[model samples]
Target: MICVDASGVRLAQPDKVLFDGLDVTISRGDRVAVVGVNGSGKTTLLRILTGALRPDSGEVRFGRGVRIAMLEQDPLLPPGTVADYLGDGWEVAAVATSLGVLPLFDRPTDQLSGGQAKRVALAKMLAENGVGAAAEHDMIVLDEPTNHLDLEAIEWLEARLVSMSAALVLVTHDRHALDRLTTQVGPSKVVELDAGRAFVHQAAKGSSAYATYLDARAERVDREAKEESTRKILARKELAWLRRGAPARSTKPKARLRSANEIVSGGPRDLGVRGNDLELGAGSTRLGNQVVELVGVGQRFAVDGSDAVTVFRDVDLVIEPGARLAVVGPNGSGKTTLLDIIAGRRAPALGQMKVGSTVVVGYADQHAASLDPDITVRQMVAGPLREPDHEDKALLERFWFDSTAQYAPTRMLSGGEKRRLQLVMVLARKPNLLILDEPTNDLDLDTLRSLEEFLDDWPGAVVLASHDRAFLDRVADHVLAIEPGGTMRRVPGGVTGWLEERSTRRSASPVRTTKVADAATSSSAGAGASGGGVAAGSRGKQKQASSGPSPSTIGRRLRETEQAMVKAQKRVDDLHAELASTADHVVLAQRGEALAVAQGELDELEARWLELAELQDG
Candidate 1:
């Protein structure tokens, strides 16, 4: 059944016509992804789909009694507590807990952070698990649903979306989710908007829709290139005829020649201004040997003047010239705090952070504090200057903000556009040392490619935190991993190297070193709260018993537990898929029970797997 049907639609803005004569249809069981460059009307199209905005001219028809659960990028919280907004139910609790928002149930909705609000909104949409509010909705439309989500939460959201029977339409930069979208009954589809036109790519059964879209887009690009060549040839012939004064018009001389003149003037601009890769300028900085170094760095906060809580303690790291370091860990692992200390934005309570005298730091912050929403894009870059010189304009242009976009306020920009603007603001400073946090979050695919290209050859020491797998693999030379326990270690390889050992890390033991001094805890939880030197690295090895389970036996059990965990997880996924594909109430109830059982078994198996891994290594 069709959820939304819009044909011959048109929308326009002050600077450009977003789209013209657009035709779109979303039906139940269709997994559709809308892709476009920043400000290409991705969000506008979603609004039109949900009937929030009326097109200038079109026929928009929804299926009879259709219902849609829409999640916008900036969601408004309803007036109530979190628990009141989402009903009291087990299904709701399960999804909310997965999103890391269950702890906020007692807090007022207005008191929650932006990330918390986003997760709460997501959980509300998914709480039904396709048997309550979700089942009633004929379609679900979301915009940038993965922006504030962590890696684990993103995975859970992907599974939940796949398990819903409602039609799925979303705009996102998450590459993982785009590849795994296999709907219950229909093939996955991608609608890419470019140059006021929409191109549809549909994947065949059991194939990756995103990969198919890339191949198709490449072919279309080649086709457009050939067509441009033909146009150029025709224009040249027409130009020669016009110059030769060989063709005489009857009455309308210049008027009849207008069409040919337009053809000659239009090739790339008429198509679009998606030209020239992003260029980054680095004003020369003579660098010494040292970049940024943190010696015995640690931070702790006092709890109401009664006790102290330590975030991380006794850390030491050195960054030199030409270093490419990627800080990675699960969310809330103090990655951002470490980066801030390195940038000199914040100081550590227990250690020294030294920056080279010649170091010019340019920080692209996750929450861009420099972006003034009320100011124009050009003003944000040029500060208080009444007239931004030609260089400032050119700099903004290089980052895909054309003249019209430069004149527009930053508040008017799309999510991706705002991110691109933030990058411009940071790079305009030409700092030799760059510290970027979550830099690839909302950037378009093309912009990401351009940034990667720039970082590939740019002569600068870079440090960043990102979850984009491809970006991390291409840009980082070394990896710094942080655990929830505040343990930091340098992984030999970057993301790829760490991922290679992720499956077996459970059985791997932390390498211990003899710290000639005592390691002291800064928290009141431990007795040793003060020390002269960093003692964080002296984790004494747990001696193995000679009469307990043999090492070989533990290794065998570890392998067996891993196999069982994988099997049980696969069973859970299969059950979710089956539950989504069916509509019979009785079948759904039965499958739900089985799914719960399977999930519990999977969790138990995973816990056992970790225990065996520790036993094997310890």
Candidate 2:
């Protein structure tokens, strides 16, 4: 059954067309992911689909008795407490609890943080789908649903969405969620928008459709370039012939002359600058042996102006030169606080923190709060240098800030453009110690990829706290996991290890298994894993799971651990051979790193096997 059908949709802005002749039919169980560059009309399309905005020339029809709900990028709420805003329902309570917004139930909605508000909005939508009711939303539309969510929350949402019966349509920059939610088979479709044109691609549920689209798009661009080059050559020849200015040419047919003129006047094309051109050049200064050192660092805050709540404690770590540390934990696990301590923005209540004198910290928070809206782009970049020059203009151009944009007030820039400007400003300082807290928040995928490439070879220490799994996988070589009870543990496989541990925990629980299928397979893998402490009733069961393994479980785990160790060792061996054979320095470095990671995984597996073996022997 068709839930919603949009026919001959056409919309335009004063400056340019957003989309033309767009036809989309959303049927029962259809999962569509709308993707494009930041301003390529993703949000606009969502608004149209949800009926918030009507296309200039299109008919939108909804199936009878088919309810729909939308989670806007930034939703507005009436004056009330968080709980009041959500209303009374078990599903609402469950979703709030899962998203770690239950604690904010009594908190006024107006006072909620951006992340808190987003979570509340998401929970409200999820609740409306009706947890176990006979009737649920037939179609659900979400725009950037994962924007402010942490990895755990994202995984949970993925799980819930997988278990949901409603058809899903979403627009997001989160590649992981996109891959999980949509598929080539069935009714899943990847609708890509480019330059006012829409291209639909069919890809499998777990496939990297976005990546595939990028490759296909690049090939198409190359082909067009080659065709254009041929035309340019003919145009040049025609101009050269016309320049002869012979009397015979004047006598030639007017039509021939007109064709000649058209060819000659084609002119040189614009370079078509892109986000990839943005150069986040490494800092001029080199980092010292010690960038930051923390000993027994702990942070606690008073909750609702009452009893002190421990966020994290007894943390010891060192940030050395060229170190890349990825922080992972549930929301409210103090990841941001950890970065704050390292950046020296906030003093830890019960720990000693030291920063080297030469280590200049460049901190980019979620919101580009350091930027002044009144200033122009050129002014912001040049303000720190205290002068504007040809060099500054050149730098701005590299970051895609044209002369017009450079002169425009910062407020006139889009969210992505503003974020890029903030990035340009931060890197201008040439800080040796770079700390990013949710740096991907407002960034386009192009800029995000460029930044990742920049950091790969950057000669400085990096501390990144982000929920972007792809970013973490590309940037981080090690992981600092803030576990429950304020204890920090280093995961051997970086993001891979953190995910593995979470996977194990989820697989072990029968309740979780029913709620969240494996993240690798399901559209949603997180429905119940909340960063908020477990409910009072579940604490005992959680404690039991945390305790030492039982006899039968130990034997089973021992066998699995042994098998994993063998596989890991084999992987390490393969990487070593590849590293030895590789001639390119870049390839060699990558293989070497892979070997090290494989060896670390092997070691961890061996250790786990030993522990299980000992328990089984007893």
Candidate 2 global TM-score: 0.76
Would you give me the overall lDDT of model 2?
0.72
What does candidate 1's lDDT look like per residue over 1-618, in tens digits?
Answer: 999998988888876777787777888878989887777888999999998999988889999998888898889998999999988877887777667676678889999877679888988888754466535688999888887775556766888888777889998877777777643347578888887777777878777777888898878787888989988998998788688784455656666477679878878423333444554635437666677777667776664474555666556666766566788765555678888888998889876878888898889877753478889999888778466788779889778787888999878887778888888777777788888898877777767778887776556678888877777777775577664445566654556566556535534843211110111132122111111111124223232335555333453455457668878989999999999899999999999999999999998888888887676445
Error of 2 at 240 (Å): 3.2
TM-score per prediction, in order, is 0.77, 0.76
- Cα deviation at 271, candidate 1, in Å, is 6.4
TM-score of 1: 0.77
lDDT of 2 by residue, 277-379 (tens): 6445443487666668776677777755765666666665656666677888877778899888888889998879888888888888777654788988898
